[model samples]
Target: MRFALLATTMLAGSALLASCATKEAPVPVTPAAVVEAPAPAPEPAKPAPQLGAFGFDEAGMDKGVSPGDSFYNYANGTWAKNTPIPSDRSNYGMFTVLADLSQKRTQGILEEVKANPNSKIGVAYSTYLDTGTIESKGLAPIQPWLNQVKGLKSKAGYAALLAQADRNGVSIPFGSYVGQDDKNPEVYALNLSQSGLGMPDRDYYLSADAKQVANRAAYEKHLTNVLTLAGEPNAAARAKAILAYETEIARVHWTRVDSRDATKTYNKMTLAELTKKAPGFDFGGYFTGIGAKVDYVLVSQPSAVTGIAKLIRSTPIAVLKDQLLVRSLDRFSAVLPDAFDKENFSFYGTTLSGTPEQQARWKRATDWTAGALEDEVSKIYVAKYYPPETKAVMDEMIKNIIAAMGRRIDALEWMSPETKVKAHAKLAAFTPKIGYPDRWRDYSDLNIVSGDALGNVIRANNWAHEENVNHLGKPLQRWEWGMTPMEVNAYANFGMVEIVFPAAILQPPFFDPNADPAVNYGGIGAVIGHELSHHFDDQGAKYDASGTLTDWWTPADVAAFKARTDALVAQYDLYEPLPGMHVKGALTLGENVGDLAGLTVAYDAYRHSLGGKAAPVIGGYSGDQRFYLGWAQVWRRNFREPAMRQRILTDPHSPSEYRAAVVRNLDPWYAAFAPEAGQKLFLQPDQRVRIW
Candidate 1:
């Protein structure tokens, strides 16, 4: 996956800027389930049968669904039909199963901590229990923050308020993160970008589509409920005013496409220069509050950030206070009272994401504790689940795949030799962080107590903020990790110029150690290829071997790459998940590039693994057939219609339906399935994209 570096705002993205993603978050909404959502997941007592190395998943397949018609359904049709999406989830598939398994282990750790709180896990566990006290406290926890907001009578104070909010990990007018300077790629620097919206994407405010209009209406009601609960006056009218402010902010934002371009967003300026360019907000005070030491900051989307200063200044003081109060309530409501929690779920869970019910409190608390004390929980997770052998095996697999990518780059006809030399240098320098970070993050300073739910989270957030910024003026910690061992996701860091596969993602169906080479190559093998390919994707390609965001490509090679990416974009744009709702081709171009490259290289590695011997037939499938199936099984998803529709609009990844279609771009897929003429998936040989 193209790793999105940690930023001040990861809250809402209608599209992904390559190399990053926000941890899952909920937005306020209404209770409008068109089709009744799935029921809560049933807990089975017995262990599931271990997937075999070579045995076919006969039950997983739909015999009648032809591979040529739709390979995703052909491989996963039976499972999709039989399995219901859990009531607490918007979608469920292979990844969800792995996540649920990891959650089960994480819960065991938290439950132990809850019973016996101590130095390491005590704070996170006690904070989890604090939610029980939230009802009795009854908005008292946020009263201090509310009073502070109300007292912000001057625009000068807005900057400080944002600084304070940043300590608690909340998004305000803008967000900042400590990352490598894109130009220097050696020392850590503070990066700021446009933010402060209550909605998930800027387009939610700008789009005239019916779904956006209805969801926006639901959001207005959601804002009203949250604000009214917080004891604010004129909740409905306040929501209207807030929406307009966000809409204007959205209008000025660099489009999602522009945001994805590294060359476009990397505008570095001195603090003094920034003040002159975007003069209303107090950078001097803001920098002081945040303890930023950098002489220069990278202002991503400068126009949008500058526009934010204008919005903050032009808006009335009362509206600004209301904005802070309402967003705070929306953000913290899940931990507040039953009413607040339920209301939060009504919209974000049901209306927007199509989850029918909220998860159990313990489950929700489990997530919070995990976030607050990730490394602490991960210490236990690694011991209980991830063995040393797994990491060793993963290391071997990564080497094979990287070697495969190296060969492909050497053979690229479109790339000039000059670009290939630099690309090769990058491949040689490519680092892989598998299983866990060499260094574990300390949460000693993050305060957590039994009764103060809000304070505990704020302190935790502050600890996180301080930890991130503390790296300033120091060498970049190349061994540092972005995601924890317990996180069931992978990332490719453009800053560190590395690929990370967390311990949790190392399990089957992504990586079945016991499975045959073909199976492993198809599943986790594709994921590894995907992350490596990200380094060469539109965004990652701009960065040099040292991780600087500098172009090393010859002009002729750059044009050829764009021509291919343009073709890839047009191919994906044709896929429509909902009426009039096609996936944003340009918005998802980087990810599409990664997906195409990852799967292609994975197939090549699998062939290389064969070492000239013909592939063996496993059950009824050939090696090639199982390879495609392995890839297909990874993306086997069952999504609620509304959730599917929303993801089509917002997620940088193409819909699961089309993610399976990534196989269509590969030549082996046609050869394996032999997609004949007139088949829905059939593409002429000349039309196939072979960019890897």
Candidate 2:
């Protein structure tokens, strides 16, 4: 989704300035007959509520009724029955606002393309954005580029292609390629996940799990589709080619993860060692291509060294032809800013935090979002919006959530004793980053235009990129944060044992000092728990306690986790957004697991924090009920369908409605509040899946 990048701020007008850059419940408690009484009437099949109707006039009576409820029929009742998933989205949410705004902005830009109609950049973007033709065919504008890749016939052709990428400032190393880092050695990094492998991990390729076997079959099919789409005529031959190329890439990819943690411990390294370690692949040429000047390589995964050695030996020069894709990939990657801006305006500009005015003001305030932090504007912004009281509350909430999670971990009967220890250690290792950065990033070198919108943006991004690449060779800047202090998002990076909640998100619907602790705990506190739970989510559990990406869980624990997650995936996959569309549950399992765990742990923390205080009434419902309502209210939003479709294919998070509905459906505490028999939003005792 498009929006501003993490780090600094940009005014919407400033955003508009760079015309060229575009690139930017449950029932419970009551014994058997209470639950059975609700069972006889089929729960009245409450008609699904409209996305806008989720809120009630009361402060907390509208718990499950809030907008942005679950997308699934089972959870959302009548709302799912009547509401249709927009043709353009797989799921829907506040993101639709952002998407619509971007479309309008892009449409304005596109109108300029139509009016002036013929600059190189305009033509390029028009060709890329022509949805009528390209979207139907899955980015068909790249067909000619794909043909060029097909034409390569020899190792020399491959070398020439690599040289071209270097000339064009692209960086490709086996599986992924990034070109912008040519000037800053610290900027280069790869997102190890989402490499388009059907198998869960490299281990699946080498394992005997029946599911893995099926995944291999699916991988072959998926590769066949990609190759065919790329112009390969013979499915069988294309599958072989894709398999061979991917296997080699996976060899390198797997190695990088094998020892990522140890490598992150120290940043001192020589270029000679780096080159010697990963032979065949030309680091000097690659580094030169990206303009990176690293004192030491930031080996995020220590195991990357292992991959370097294996890639040096096992990879064949013949297989290198696939690297030709890197150039186009780099170009596409560059366009991410454009794509993101066009898609996620609401997410970045609205929901996460901030009004359009605030967002616009942010742009003007901390104009250099990417390059520097701790700017005067940022400090002021924090002081204005993120008060010390909120920060203190957040710190306490995190502690409570973590403690609650630990209590849950202690109760896991399925986990082995050894696995539990590792889990606990990982939990302990988690470093919570709340409010703003402890140390602001240095952006003195990045020159902001002050008024030259596009120039300022490019400079800021370039500076940030440089900072990232320079992390190589130097000690791991444990304090170097990834997200801006003012950003509205929160994140859990397993590699770093870090969880971040920026100041922008610490606001209404998430946290309110006057609100009951249950509500706050259910809202932002759950967000914290959700992030923390990532350490043990489906993909996260693969990583070991030290925050290294590894397989530390026992076979049984792994099986149980998957068994539960698989059900969740299937349940979500069945939710048809449009007539024929459904959410890809597997793609979203990691976040879903986090969502489930977050709500559970947050609720537990609330219960413990209450210290036996009676549930006070606020607005018509008890405080217990208000907590759920507060949680739902936070997600209250509406979306245009066109944008919703796009999110389903790309976003990992479920629609806001489903995000709330599913959690409430699984929340054991929800039933305690709304125990009215035969009411909708009540859950059967047998339906619950409590995995925290």
Candidate 3:
């Protein structure tokens, strides 16, 4: 969900901006009479590097000062030190600019609505923000619902209610009901993702490695403590309820590795087939509750669904309401967003060349574009904003990125030759989706009328739920894009073997040609590597080239990979940013792996580009050295306590400080940037995690 927002913003970046020029403005005529003006005909042909072009800089490693004093560290560190948190923003990062801008626009809208008390959007906002005070109905809906669920005296009845809640609470449209699928005999296999801690993915909770698991434990405790502050004053009773809720939900919160990519390949199953696999449960009602208007649903394993349904019918409701299940859903909805933002600020924000103003314009345009006016928006954007040169740069960047990925695959050591071949085949099969989608989502059915904020959210969510539910038993649309076209971030779906770069992130500090290659590599190129590496991350590694959730790793290699990943988890676990908050290395292992592997691949690519020739001055540091600095600078951020706490519980990536420190500590390339054998910069030796 954190990445979803990031992806949305990224997609919006490519949308058309509204025309700035007024129709009435007349073109100024050049003066024909001035003698001095005539002399201006021979204006000097000033030589400057073409926009988006970089000139080679020959700077060898420049390491005399401490790493804390490095240019990039100083620039970002200075900002981190001085920038105060704005009241409107919960967290601080480059995207803070976007949020600030959004707030300004939203405030303007709010003011307009306030002036016109009858406006739809105004009413929606008012209602959503009311906290139920308007009608003295604070959480009344929840109370009734809870009571209905609680009234189920029998275990069978209670189990049905719990299953309903699981469906209701699962944040993502596709992931609910996975544990009940008939395919996996291990009922809880899909349910492994739940834990009370507010973070993304189950790996964050279960991994016992040094870096992430340690953080996971601390994060869990800290979050529980925070919740205590928000819970009922009757500590013991509240604790009992919470524990009751947590473990119950965790039991049913199924895990689906790379769900985005794999969704399309799942076949559909009829209600009769589903019933046979898992009897006693009312299959028809469950489908109806899920709003499945269609006859069949896309099922990765019809067998699993049937099996899970059987388990639901047989298992006691108490067992279904396991603490892990409740916590998993709660965390998925609440915590994942903050975790992603904290880990890679630039990945979701200023990594691109565009300004916040430009991004805001893009987002508004894209949101509107997804409606009936999509063609109009696309045409306008292509004609007015999508420059030929920009397209060329994007095309070239994609080519280089894909090529670099091939090189990385060829260089893998632990992978068996057979697996490497398969990896290459997957890479070859990979699809590159850049900028906008070929098919825009069908938003025609959505009605934005009656702008009651609560109504609007409910309608939007209902529409989404209906859309997902309607997919039952239909052929998967391979061409369907998971993210909107104008989002601000990029991602790789390992199941699909596809990488997507939204229009939002293709600009600025991340991609302009004027910036040094070292910076670009550290910025966007490393990001490319990160996404590419996700195909091999702990979870992503579970999915094979066919986009199926099956193990492909050799037994020995899997063990070794886990060991290497475990070490990364340990390294990050020790980092403590606040009084009680700590990084959950297990939760962040995938990202941590991406950070390390991305940097490694990008650095290797950069070195290969130079043919191994040492460079002599980039701001007094070698090109190689500056490359790493540029990487660290991308993650520089600032945040307030509420925002920081929120992110700590939810996000999968480490904090910005750790994003830089943790990755660099494990990277030998960073040592070149701060080449002092015993310097603090070299916190860990290469031998520690020599794995690719």
**Model 2 misplacement above 4 A:** 1-284, 291-377, 448-458, 664-670, 673-684
lDDT of each: 0.82, 0.53, 0.51
Query: Candidate 1 lDDT, tens digit per residue, 1-692?
Result: 12244334223324322432556564544445334434545554333325744523657888698877888889888988999999889999888888888888888887766756465465556565665678888887778887988888788788888788777776787879988888888877888898877777787788888888998899889988888877777889998988888788888877778887898888989999899888789987788788787799899999998998888888887887787877777678766777888888898889888899888877777788888888888888888888788887888888989999999998999998888999999999989998997777766666677667777777877888888889998876787788888888898998778999999898887876557678789888999999999999989999889888876999998899988998889898898878888888998988889889998888888899899999888776889988888888888788998888778767788887688888887777888888887877777888877787
TM-score of each: 0.91, 0.57, 0.62
Considering TM-score, where higher is better, how would the candidates rank from best to worst? 1, 3, 2
In model 2, what lDDT does residue 417 have? 90
What is the clash tally of candidate 1? 8
Over 485-597, each residue of candidate 2 has an lDDT whose tens digit, in order, gives: 54557898666678998776775557656556666777788889899998778766766655555567889887887777877777678666655557778767778888889
Candidate 2 weakest lDDT stretch, 10 residues: 48-57
Give the TM-score comparing model 2 with the true structure, all chains together: 0.57
Q: Give, for candidate 1, the lowest lDDT window spanning 10 residues.
A: 1-10
Better of 1 and 3 by TM-score: 1
lDDT of 3 by residue, 31-62 (tens): 54433212223443434322222332222112
Best by TM-score: 1
